[model samples]
Target: MDSEKELSGKTVLLMAIATGIIVANLNYIQPIEGLIADSFQVSKAAVGVVAMLTQLGYAFGLLFIVPLGDIFNRYHLIQIMLSLSILSLLLAFWAPSLIIFGVASLLVGITSVAPQIIIPYAAYLAPSLHRGKVLGNVLSGLLTGILLSRSVSGLLGSVLSWQYVYLIAAIACTILLGVLHLYLPRDPRQKQHMQYGKVMASLPKLLAKEKHLQGSAINGFCLFGVSNVLWSTLAFYLAHQYHFGSGVAGLLGLLGITGVLFASIIGQMVDKYSPRMTVGLGILFSTLSFVIFTSLGHLFIGLIVGIVLLDLGTQFGQVSNQAIVQSLSLQASSRNNSIFMFSYFLGGSLGTFFGTLAWSNFGWSGVCLVGTIFLVLALLGHLFLKEPEKLQKVS
Candidate 1:
């Protein structure tokens, strides 16, 4: 049966729930940084190690793990990962120090492969005409879960303590594992995939051949670099400079979420019009939004307004960029997403790192400067020529 035909009562709920739970795992560390540090009797920098460990785990997982979807029984793989992720969460919850907690965070990060699975599943299930919009819908859920994780983590830490935050996430992980074991469909494609070695060796060859793919990857890279800076460091500015707390900073995430909704709408428009327009407009807002944030630093209402614009800019560009990449590859659909999203996450990781660096050096002003420069580069990356044509970046 077509997978669409299988989106029946239990299956739909199971998939949605599984997707949300797994995706939410990515952000569970943010809200409880202070508490986690106190537990270990370490400085805040020690907990920062957990964030890097998890991000590195995710980067390595995408390098090896997400690609496995093309060549394995994703159902079984997801189940195994979710089980291990639950164990990891429990480890994080009960850890005595930051070192042990960092190890647990690494395990949890590597195993939380839900969004990678969901994106490809959407690719497999949806037809071309509706793919962009459907992918946007799925991404909207993913982004919302990401934003809300901080808030939920805050509340969980507030009422019950931070350790309980991970425990609750463990419970969530267990529930998702059960649902996937019972309901997610197994793919026949697993048996048909090539040797894993060939798949692993092919990234260079793939990049060597596809100019459009490279452009798409670069687009994702530059665009997400800007977003990574804003979201990662804004909380520091709000907390230290403005004297805001976790509650208020978490609320500020809604600005990005609102931008995501607007971007989702723009993604649908990509299907109806020129993809170049989508890229152009998205870049425009990204640059402008950050400028406003920088220029109006002390004005609370202006910061809110700028963030809303900033997020809309980012979501629109990202969704459209994915659509562009996916449309270029017929046989390499999963591989296409692997490259595109790898660049997206890779860019985010680097962006966050650099944003932190800038925050350390130039303070909030420097952070916004880095963000604006990336946005301008993204915009200029589009300026030279074809959206429909490939970029000159690759040889």
Candidate 2:
């Protein structure tokens, strides 16, 4: 552990950028599915295997790997995981067939759990007053990476080759790996000496012990699921309803920059206000976004309006939710984060499934309704949780 307890701006910036770069690997294939399909002479839908496998791999790692942050030297774990991610990208870059690419993508997702470790580690380094603010900054970088990945991938696929994106990402990851190794401070907390099995077994206990964590995790799941419902089929909706190309569909990610900006501000708000209030405010925006999409999304302007609302609302809720969870147990921050993110992405997978079904059966209208239903459930779940009456006395 580093003797220094306070975080530096330079450290925060590196953490933020590293998180963004790591997470971008998961999204890089999304906008280039068509090019990948063309390369392998497969249907566009088949090319989705890379993205799906990557997500599944991430879920697996969250369940199995991220908890190690609680037990091992996190700095060592981070370096090992990031190096593995770089190798995965290299494999993906040279993949000759869809099958090999899918495998490599899965490895990339698994290794990308490095950021989950990084986030909690950052939380540990900050003062309680600024934890949310620091997390917000990191999440903004993550959001930028996710959004820009689609734009960059689309442009590269059009002008060069989709494989070039993976190659470039590999190079970027290598640079980030070296930087992180050279600069990141060691965790100040003493490492847990728990066995691997004990570490894995502790997750259920963590969930059972923390009602707030459960509430936040459930809320996160529903919110992320709602976002995925719209995102998974956005290109299809653009093509069918607006006669737009994939390039245009990719640009919708830029609308999410609104969310990125809000993430940092919302963190400050969470510290000044209550997490419950912030979450409620975010839910209002989410509900409004769905209402607009349902009634007026046929217009380009309406779709844009819906995109901004959804992204902003989701970020507000997410930042607040994460703040609440990270505050639960400092000793178990990584495990708590793992459970939270696992549920979050599981919700995403569910959303993708139901969104595909809704789009197939009822078109964009169904998508809107499904997303609304998710928000409603999330709101209700949040409402049912016991508010922290103690927090009222903090200030």
Candidate 3:
């Protein structure tokens, strides 16, 4: 055993590793959609099957894996999941067909428990006064992971085979896993309330009982819908419209990462002022991004500006959403986060599915429409959201 004494400095490093693990899995998959479709000799629509499966896998992980935090020793659970994540990524890399690729992606998604583990870990580490800040910083890494994964993958896809990308991630995960085992703080809690059937049964009642959590989750869903539309299809649109190669298209992801780089600022603001204010401002930025994109008329600068607004707005809303969801269910933070994140990814899957089709049909104009609608709906959800009793007490 390490020590009953705190791991101190290692917690942040552990959080970073956890964030990186999922980023390596999820974002890397975005730019390669077209490539994978071609590899499978399937229509673009079928690529959605892959996206859906990956998200479904994530939802499964959220439901089945995250709850263990409230029940088991998180230390052991994280190690097992991290190891499985490594094996899953390897299987994904060496898979024979797109069919196998999809399956591996699903498993990798399932085992990518990095975020679930780390968020709670952050909660466990910080004092209440600094809890939101710690979470924000850690989550910023997760968001960055989500952004850079696409950006880096797009930048690298043409130069190297996609399998090598997963291979690189596998190596990274292995190093991080070892580091975590060596240094991560031990869990303070034990497994107790893990009746899987009971947890599943309570979801509906939980949703009904916790309207605030539901609303926050809905808002997150819409926010992710906006982001996923762009990420899932932007490479195709940029390539098809302006005849730019993967490199420039990938650079757009960096432009959007501007938002992620600023998420901690939003977190700070959430601590200082109201989460609603940050969310409202984010909605405005998101709307501006969509409008600029539609009017860009294939000018490169227009694309750059669009990326900035979209990413910033998306992440701002996300940071606030995380704050709100975490506040709403102190007893069931993991479960609440799971539901909230699952909705967000579900919306992403829908955005990726329909957004890709819309792109093929109406081009950038179509994507702008999808993003605009989702952002608007998200804004509405945020506006209508009420803080639960526990959140108010925390505030």
Best by TM-score: 2
Query: What are the lDDT scores of the predictions, listed in order?
Result: 0.69, 0.82, 0.74
Worst 10 residues of 2 by lDDT: 386-395
User: Candidate 2 lDDT, tens digit per residue, 1-395?
Assistant: 33135578888888889888998888787666656777899865565545667777887888899999999999899999999999999999999988999899889888888989999888888777788888899888877888887777767776787898999999999999889889998766665778889878889999999888888888888888898778777766886887765677678878999988888898888878788888887788888988988888999999999989988888887888888888887788899999998887777767766776677678898888899889988988888974342222110
Candidate 1 regions off by >4 Å?
Answer: 1-17, 34-46, 188-190, 384-386, 389-395
Measured by TM-score, how close is model 1 to the native structure? 0.88
In the range 340-376, model 1's lDDT, one tens digit per residue, is 7777667766676777678767888888888877876
What are the root-mean-square deviations of the candidates from the true structure over C-alphas? 3.8, 2.5, 2.8
**What TM-score does candidate 2 reach?**
0.93
Which pairs of residues clash in candidate 2, taking residues 3 or more apart in a chain or in different chains?
none
User: Judged by TM-score relative to the true structure, which candidate is superior, 1 or 2?
Assistant: 2
TM-score of each: 0.88, 0.93, 0.92
Error of 3 at 333 (Å): 1.3
